[model samples]
Target: MASAFQAKGLQYWVSELAQAVLPILPGSAVEIRRLLEHPDTSLNQIGDLVAQDPVLRLHVLRACNNQFAEKAAGTLSNPHHCVSMLGMDNISALVDSLKPDCGANNRFEPRYLQAIIQSSHAAELALSWLPFRHQGNADQLVLACLLYGVPDWAMWRVASNEARMIDALVQQQRVPVEEAELAVLGCQRAELAKALAQHWHFSDQVCGAIHGAPIPSPAFLMRYARLAQKHSNDAASVRMPNKTEAGLLAHSQGFTVHLSNTLAQQSARSWYSKPTLRCQAIVAAYLDQPLVRILELTKSVALETSRRFAIVGVQSPAEGLLWPQPSAQRRRIKPSQMDAAVTKMASMLGQGSVPAKAPKSATPAPPSQRPDPLNQPRAIGIKSEKLPDGLDHHAIRSAPKPAAKPAAVFPGFVSAEKYADYETLINKLLHQPSAFSSEQEALRSITDCLYRCTELERVVVAVLNPERSKLEAYYAQGCSEAPALQRFTVQLQPPNLFTQLLRQPAATWISRERQQQIEGVIPGQFRQASQCEDFFLMSVFNQQGAYGLFYADRGLTDRIGLSEAEYKIFKSTGAHCSKYLMALQP
Candidate 1:
């Protein structure tokens, strides 16, 4: 009887701790759960629902990856892939797993509920306007917007005291949330959220969006726009915008002003019916603002929004979007000290412990003492002083060179005849100037054709930025469902893989052996961002310097080899594109 009582007590304690740390799914997510319960629901339909809620999306992705990591051969990056991999049955099971008690009956503070509602509103705004501007998947925009303020929700759940303090600082001290978080906790909320997201194995694009990095993708831009609009405030400290103000601001930002205003009013009406002070404040503020003042606010708001979320700029620590490591101050606790452990965990969540500094050594090492053999120069083209007894030195010195090895062929490529037919189709498209209306259309069509003809898992077309310093992907196929491809970018600095490839006129296949040699030049974060293991890069150019490049890969597949014929065909496609580009020049 005593032992059973102790076990029951321990279970209760654990349940409390879980409630403190685990996030509650918002209303939209609960609705999605209901939809998932139905037998007729499709994976795409569930994916669409999951994409609109960040907390649900994160949970779904984590569950799917954890359950099917071996079968998928890799961690799934997008919700669509997760749904497709897990199927409707597994997805329903996942929803069941997350169906905890979350509603008005739960003891949640009004402020916490308000923040979630605001986040949902931001998602709704993105869903309404972002699809009109961007290509690729609309679901991406929804996910990005929903997750833009996830750090706040995370903090609210795990460390309510710190969350309250940050709110106090923002409201009373009139400081920005980021600044207040840094001043009080010595770490930014976004950084903490990014660390948690990484722990949950979120894609680099999601992490980057949370970190407010310049991703240049449409979803990233829409996320920034929604966040900027959500966080925009007036001199009077109003958190929500007036309907007229929202409409004008939306118009300035190239959205449909009337639709935006209608949505704003609808959200406002819903909030007004709620019994929250924050909701009342929004309605009151909207009533007080004049049209002239609202119009005046639009100019500064637009300028500030642009500056806060610029598409192109130098990368900073905030923009670096790296996964943070745990602080050295965090220590393991014994199981016996359950109460103390729980308290410590809560404190750690609320106030991130500062990392301890390393003690300095007695003295620094001299340059000569730190010699590296890999950096040392080696003698080349020098004849040896002695030869083996059986060796003929004259024959060895004057031996004819062996023939060059042929390029490797990719596995599962079509036969030579079929490949010829594919090439014929591509060449015909390239030669026909009237087939495409413009240079971009022609380039995009070629990439699409290559993706279809080659039957590769992924293909992308990246062009040099106007500065000729960075390569940014503008067109991609096969992997449009993946977020990484949509936001792929590479710098062309020296000693980098991209620079090495750009210097050569021919296409180069990145085998595993070669990938290791250039690992130093290619950062691990870049690899994570692209989420591709093996690929071939072919530069496209014509007389004027190299303008763009084609990247193809069988991403996340077991097939890892590229054949000589495949390489030739890949290079031939680029050559055809080059010829078409040359013909377009005046």
Candidate 2:
């Protein structure tokens, strides 16, 4: 049987290659993501991983100590220093690209090793023939020609037979791969390589190198091929100026060069992994597990690719120069790099743990079993302490005691004369500033709401925190004391808390923290305390959606012990505020 590596077809082969190589790369993506559940995994552990890989460790240091980060003024000598300066995610991404799994080794079989080497040599020659600026892509073109014969093995082909055909074309026929494929197998190796390259997720450039017209200048090919073949005898420190020369043939066709027999022999002896016919070593380990679990492992790699490739951009103004200075950092990778990611993501669904046509119900348990407690936290103490009769779990946190009668403000302020204007002010803040649009308008609107609303005195309005999934203070007028605002800010989900309650249309729903927050409200929007507050969450909402205002007080005004009619008005007013608040969109 041919080795697993000799198989053709892009998706299947890439997936196989990826499975083979990902374990060698370390840091299975699943393991990386599981960190979301464990916040304590520090930068130290990650630094150690980088230190283990000589190439990656050096790159990490270079990037961190680069000109862009020079001003950060941190002395980072190693992976530990890397994590502290660059952050975990950033460091992980840098090391990820260096993995062997990233289409680093293109050729699958050792049978045509000589032909592959010679073809790669020819590609180098073609690159050298180009102008100085176009030399950079030589590595890409060389790898392209090396694997040019791959597409032909797409169907099942016996390994010994495949090896004989490759040898006949190269050692016997003494021809290049493109001719070798056609003369011996009746098709061009370039065509087969192109098909396989496309199948495996190779970039357009690589495919073009294998199949595109040969480089225009024979002299260039002669130079590049000679130098590339000499690469073995030359010092390891030497690197060709591929970037310089390849620039001239940016979009044009390039040709191949032949690797000397000696270099081909040396490379095969030093670099090749012994072929494993069945891939039984790794596949056997995986066979016992559910397919879903296997896919889970692969999905992590796909997710990593997406995150690495995701570019963040700032708007470049049209009125300015045609192209802005490349302020935005750009990291380029070939199209082939994505082939493995695509196949893994697509096929991973099939390998998932559960079948699509699962049984309707789980099989019954045996004679003895305990209920699963994963969903609920197990409390050690008295179950009786759960809650007393009327109060919900929200009230589990204690609310501030209402202030003394004279200090209380809501009772005197909520009177009919003052109520109408207060209602009008809140209604105005309920939406965007066209009728009221700017940030300044938002502030002004809130100021009016606090000024006119009676003893509910001071109120503060805050925006939702995008990163933290919570509300943050935007504007606050009548709030008093850091502790009061602090209590309100905790556990307040910007849209969710109110949306969930309002959907039920409960006439009076205490906030989940209502038990912990009542005395925090002060009359006429206390201005002194709201400034220091970190998370400013006001329960001020209009009828539409967002007028979420929380009134804080030191003492209970007569309004706290309101008439049923007055209480109903407060509730209805809150609903109205909700409607208006929801109208305010970013």
In terms of lDDT, the best-performing candidate is: 1
| TM-score of candidate 2 against the unseen true structure | 0.22
**Model 2 agreement with the true structure over 443-505: per-residue lDDT tens digits:** 445444544554444444444343434444544444444545533443343344433432343
Q: Quantify how close model 2 is to the true structure by its C-alpha RMSD in Å.
A: 30.4
| lDDT for predicted candidate 2 compared with the true structure | 0.38
The per-model lDDT (C-alpha) reads 0.53, 0.38
TM-score of every model versus the real structure: 0.33, 0.22
**Per-residue lDDT of candidate 1, residues 1-586 (tens digit):** 1111111222332233234433444555567767867777777888877765556776777677567655664336578888888787777666666645343443333444444444554445444434323323454444444445555565555556555555534432234445656544556655555555555555565555555452233343344334433434644323223123223321122122222222332332222222122222332233233323433443233333334323222111122112122111111223344334234333543344356679998999997899899778654322756555677767787888888988555434544554565666576555434334345556766777677666566788887777889888877887756777756888887557677667756687877878777778775545876676677888887556777889887767647456665677688888888787665432
Clash pairs, candidate 1, are: 408-562, 408-563, 408-564, 409-562, 409-563, 409-564, 410-562, 410-563
